[model samples]
Each structure stands twice: as C-alpha cells, then as structure tokens.
Target: MKRWDAILTIDKLAAELIAENNYKGKIYATGSPAFDKFRDIDVAKERKRLRKKFGLSENVFVVFYAGAATPAGWQEDEITFKFLAEAMRKLQKKHPEAVFIAHQHPRDEKLGRYQKLAPDLKYFDISKFLPAGRQGKIDDTLLPMMDTVVGMYATNLIHACYLRISGVSILLPNAGGKRLFENLSLDDFPTKGRKNFSHLPKKPPPSRRPMRLKKN
Candidate 1:
C-alpha cells in the first residue's frame, strides 16, 4: 500500500518510529476492534457432542486458552506459558470441576509439566475441530462461555473485552518487560461519547483538500 493506516497513538508514534527507521508511507490511526463485537460463535451443541465422544461429564467447566502459541515478538516458551499454566494449576484446586482445554498453536500440544497433571489437565488441538477459515470466529465463541478467561498476549482477549465481561482475569506476562495495551488504555476507546483520540478528518466535499490537512 502507498500509505499504511495506523492504530491508536500510532500517528505520534510514527513520527519517532519513522525518524529512527527508514520508511515511506502515510500513517493514520485506525480504531479498536473491541467495540465491533459480534455474537459469540455457536459451539454449545458441538462442545456437548465432543464431550459425549470423549466420555466426559456434562458438568465440565471448559477453560479455553486458544491463541497464537508463539505470537510474534514475545518469547513463548518462557513468560506467557509459564505464568498461565502455573496460575491455572493453582486455580484448579478451587475449581475441581474445571477442565482446562488449550488449543496449541502450530500443532504442538502436550508440552512440559502439562503431561504430568493427571485427568484434569488436557490439551486440545482445535485445528482438528475448526476448519482453517472458521478458526478465528471459534475463539470468539469459546472465550465468553468459560468460567473465567485469563490469558496473556492473545488477540482473543480483545473479543472478551468487547463483551464487557466481568469475573475474567487477564495476566499480561511480558518476559522482556514492557507495558501492554489495554482496551480502556488504548487511544481507540471512546471518551464522553467522543473518540478517545483525534477525530476523523471529514471527507473533502468535491472541492479542496481537507481543511485540517490544507496549509492555506
């Protein structure tokens, strides 16, 4: 693309970003995906069906941790998994009926420490259940149904936030250590019914360039 659109405080960030890095393109901030909430994916019947296939009980409290296994820049093996798995293990004592269902990214389920914890701990490779095209929407469906959704560094959290859900806990485990973006904190969130950041430049009405962008 000629000029890529940015998101959040990206316009200002782009100034410093462009100064340090060599690049060329228009940069503008696009808004958040949180507010654009859609209906949760339909999987209730299917989950029950799968449960029957596995001989699992009907009262299972499905806890799903499905997202990028090795999402981009973050070190996957260390921080994100470490804290999450540990937290779940600790959280399990109270929720004995809980059945932790994780969809391993890149087909690697059944990893370290996870294999040892008997019946309650289980790994689910969702790729088998969801077709490639429909996988993302599945995350949207499964998250809200959980007893509590707690994860670090995953896009599905955006959907969870959109639902304005309570009781779900989020743990941002950054190993290298940097603040992460929250739905409320990001410039994309609304303020007093107005946009959190700058308003969109109104379209030019068949005349001159936008008044804000025009120098004259």
Candidate 2:
C-alpha cells in the first residue's frame, strides 16, 4: 500500500478506509473515470438517442438483468433468474410494452443454463454494437437505456444507482447473500423508488409481481 504515490477511489468511504490503514499515499475520491461520460451529457436526450439506436421506443419499459459470475454453492443466481423470469412473464402479459433483456458476465459459463431456464428472456450482447476498444465498458452505454436494472450482486447495480436508474437487488436466504449486502450497503444507497430490493423465497410465489415502471 505504501508503494504507490497516490490512490484513487470511487467514493469518500473507500478513500477514508485507505487513509485509516496507515497508507502514506495521497488519496483522491474522484469517482470512477469509467463514469466520466455521464457527467456533462443531458440524460434525457442521451437516453432517447440510445433507446432509438437500440430499437427501443420511448414508451417501452425496459428491464435489464445484469448477470454475475456465480461459483458453486452460490444459489442466488438460480433463484434470481427464476424469480425474474416468472415476474417478467407476468408483467409483460399485463403490459405488452414491457421488455426484459439480459447481459451475462464474460466469465459466467452457465449462460446457456440460465437461457434455457428462462427462455422468454432476451439476451443482448452489447459488444456487437461497441467498437473493440470500448467493448469491455458496456455499462456506460447499456445502463442508461434501461428503465430498471436487476441483479444479484453485480457492481453494475452501483452504476445504475449513479445514473439514477432504478436498481433492484435480489436477496437469497443464505449467509453469503447477507454478507454481500452488508459489505456493499446497497440498501443505504438512494434509489429511484422505494421498491428496489426483492427478497425471494425458496420458491417464487405466483402472486408476486415486479415493480411497474411509468412511461416517459
């Protein structure tokens, strides 16, 4: 920790932690440079443009599932996928304008498993639209186009929060799930609305429905 002349962090809390650890380096909480593109642009205009480029109408309600790499014994992924699939199915039936799309983690090899599990859900590969140099940074372009972002514990949720887009975190009934929420303090972050987090049961309830989005 002492080797570097300076350290940069995404937020003040992280900068404080580095300073408290007896680090001698200078600290800067300049937020993530990955989000620098979000600073000056007009969000409403950009969102419209991006949605059009992606073939989504302004009236369409888009829900984005941000998939994460899940190792063995981490049951959150399976639970979330099933829950979202069911909920989205119900939502789309009632609101034909609602659309569900997903992006899998580059390292998640079980992509086919989930796709088979939720055959109704559509997957979008943002890399196809991005230039090779920017392919790795899909969140910058993909997230703004979503009306809501859903995930188990992906950092993309934080990006959604910064963009003031609705973010939903599915909590599993296990210690791993508890620890992740405690470490991230996701509940502490302000969201677009109150119904951002969803607590799932061992089996998804047929009566349970996802939050409804108001059209722009």
Best by TM-score: 2
Top of the candidates by lDDT: 2
Candidate 1 vs. true structure, TM-score = 0.44
| Candidate 2 lDDT over residue span 74-133, tens digit each | 356767778778888888889877877666666666646566777775555555667778
Q: How accurate locally, in lDDT, is each candidate?
A: 0.47, 0.68
As for candidate 2, its clashing pairs are none
* Cα lDDT tens digits for candidate 1, 51-94: 66545576766666643445443354345555567767766777
Q: How accurate is candidate 2 locally (lDDT)?
A: 0.68
